[model samples]
Target: MRLSRYFLPVTKETPADAQIVSHKLMLRAGLVRQTAAGIYAWLPLGLRVLKKIEQIVREEQDKAGAVELLMPTIQSADLWRQSGRYDAYGPEMLRLVDRHEREMLYGPTNEEMITTIFRDATKSYRDLPRTLYHIQWKFRDEVRPRFGVMRGREFLMKDAYSFDLDEEGLKQSYEAMFVAYLRTFARLGLQAVPVRAPTGPIGGDLSHEFHILAETGESQLFYDAAIDDVTREELLAADASTIARLTRLYAMEAEEHEKVAECPVPAERLRSRRGIEVGHIFAFGTKYSASMGFSIQTADGGQVHPQMGSYGIGVSRLMGAIIEASHDDNGIVWPDSVAPFQVGLINMRADDAACSAAADNIYKQLETAGVETLYDDRDERGGAKFATMDVIGLPWQLVIGPKGLEKGVVELKRRASGEREELSLETALARLTAR
Candidate 1:
């Protein structure tokens, strides 16, 4: 991708309605455009980032031994009626009447639909403990949807469902999703703290909301400051005991905070911050299954309703949440794992012969090395090119200019740190690919 050929539109002025930093930044960056009060059209740059986040979620879900499938964006109201939520669910449900006056809706969640799917084929305890997931578009009609993609009406989401035999089986299946969520957030470079949250519409006895701390975040949380160093490997190496230990270690929502006598830490050491809930998991036993007649024969020759757990990650919300968690005054500082492009090749003097030649060489080398890069071959000024690249914020920047081309070296700069080092072309490529 090149600035000369790319469609990244950036604006210096922030929109007045964008009350939050992430929202403001997203609009200024030309990542999204508002089509209605709450609906947004994802531009090229935003779509690229969303796809990257989706890929990371997919990989983590696969690692957790969950199978993937696609579900429809629209569903029949008959399923919701069987679950007795057709009238109970309020305006958030985008209900409709079809040509034949049939009830229909753009699904806000897939509990009713997934239950219908499961009951249609699954009929035995042998096929118990099945986890199926899908990444698709979901619609929830928010009355006052604002904050860019953070609270959009139509957004991409990854929702997975697990079905098991009984309470004991439900607990194990819940842990599998719990572990999977931990790894998913870690791989996306988010320090998500699992906090017990109230089950809103998703009825369940057990629930956890994953929050990433940021000033512009929506959820207020209490968590251990040490969670900043949490990693995916810790979650992947976990079992039943490991899940309990990890959950018991520390963290809770504002309502669940403890004020008892315990490990004494100063008030400043106790970190309470605002965060956005990117993902949530809950175990609702026999709720949808019982309503939909999803019964299977057990060993004792009796029909039983299966326990189910649902896990959700806001695939599109993550783009905004990530920006909220990790950005500076200049622009978005995309984390290495989820950056749209790993390396940005800047030809400081794209019109000049020597600089263009050197940049072309570097771009080819990076491509051969299997690096995702954007070559800024545009005839923009050095400051303009640098600022645009900085706003997009690739993990690394390879600066090739006429002055540096004379020295037989290029400048390498890390997006996180402003420091720059001049290195031989060969050395620069080696250092980038080595890691």
Candidate 2:
């Protein structure tokens, strides 16, 4: 992907309406454009980042034993009616009347429809523990949608539903998602703490929202600082002897917080911090299943309403949250795991024969070697090109200028660290290949 051939419409001026750093940078970078008050049309760059985040969410969900299947964004209101929340749901529910005068809606969540699926397919406890998920768009008519994707009216989300015959079975499904959230955030380079949170519209007795700490975050979180230090591998590798160890760790939302000395985390490890809710899991025993008759027959000839749980991760909002957690003054510093491109190759003087040739060769070599890179072969000044490259935040950057090309060297600068070193062409290639 050459800069000259790319559709990135970066601007130097920040929009006056953007109130936060993440929102401002996203607009300046032209990653997204406002389609309405709280809706956006994701530009090429934003869409790429969205896909990368979506893939990571999907992989980690699969690893946690959840299967994937897509559900439609638009759902019939009849489903919600059966759940007894169709008209009771607030204005956030975008209710509408179709051409046939049938009540319908853009689904804000999928609990009702999922129940219909379960009730039709499974008749016995044999399929007791089933978890299915989908990555799709959702709509909520936010009265005052603001903060870019953080509180958008329309967005992408990964929602998974779990159905189990008994409380014992439901616990297993909940634990799977609990651990999955940890791994998903860790893999994306986020230190997310799972705090007990309100289920809101998705009623439940047990719920936890995985919050990623960021200064510009919307949620007020109080957490055990130790949660940040624990890694996904540690939690996933824990044996049955201490399987619930991670859950026992202290963490909670402002609402569920208890100012008691019994909190297991040490005083030093307790920090009241602000964070964005990226993922949430809930165990709503029989809420959706009982409402819609999604029951399985027990061996004793009794009907049992399957307990249910729903897990959600804001797939699109995560892109903005990642930028918020990781960016500096320059621009978006994308984490390598979800970076749209791993490296950027800039021809400092695209018109110069030597610089152009070297950069072209390096770009081709990197691509041939299976490296995702952006070749900035544009008719722009060196400073402008460098600034743009820094803001785009590729992990590694290769700069070939006429001056450096004459010495058979190019400037290799890493984005994470503003460290630049002149390296011979062979050495630069080697470092990039090793990455």
Deviation in Å, model 2, residue 147 alpha carbon: 0.6
* lDDT (tens digit, per residue) of candidate 2 on 1-435: 988888999989889999988889888877899989999999888888889999999998898788899888889988998899888889999988889999889999999988898789899988878899999999999999999998999999999999888898888888888877777787788878777777877897898888888988877776666566666567445333323654566777665666647666788877787888898899999888888877789989899899999999999989888989999999988898888889888888878887787788889999999999888899999899888887778888888889887787888988998899999999989989888
Model 2: lowest-lDDT 10 consecutive positions: 235-244
User: Each model's TM-score, in the order given?
Assistant: 0.95, 0.96
Q: Give the poorly placed runs of model 1, Cα more than 4 Å off.
A: 224-233, 236-238, 255-270
Across 1-435, the per-residue lDDT of candidate 1 in tens digits comes to: 666788888887879999888888888877888999889888888888889999999988887778999999889998888999989989998998999999899999999988888889888999888989999999999999988889989999999999999999888888888887877787787777888778888897899988887887777777666665556677556566656765765666665666724534345556788889999999999889988889999988998999999999999999988899888888889998888888989998867887788788889889888988889898888898788878877889999988887888899999988779999989999998886
Superposition TM-score, candidate 1 onto the true structure: 0.95
Question: Which structure among the candidates has the greatest TM-score?
Answer: 2
| Candidate 1 overall lDDT versus native | 0.85
Q: Clashing pairs in model 2?
A: none
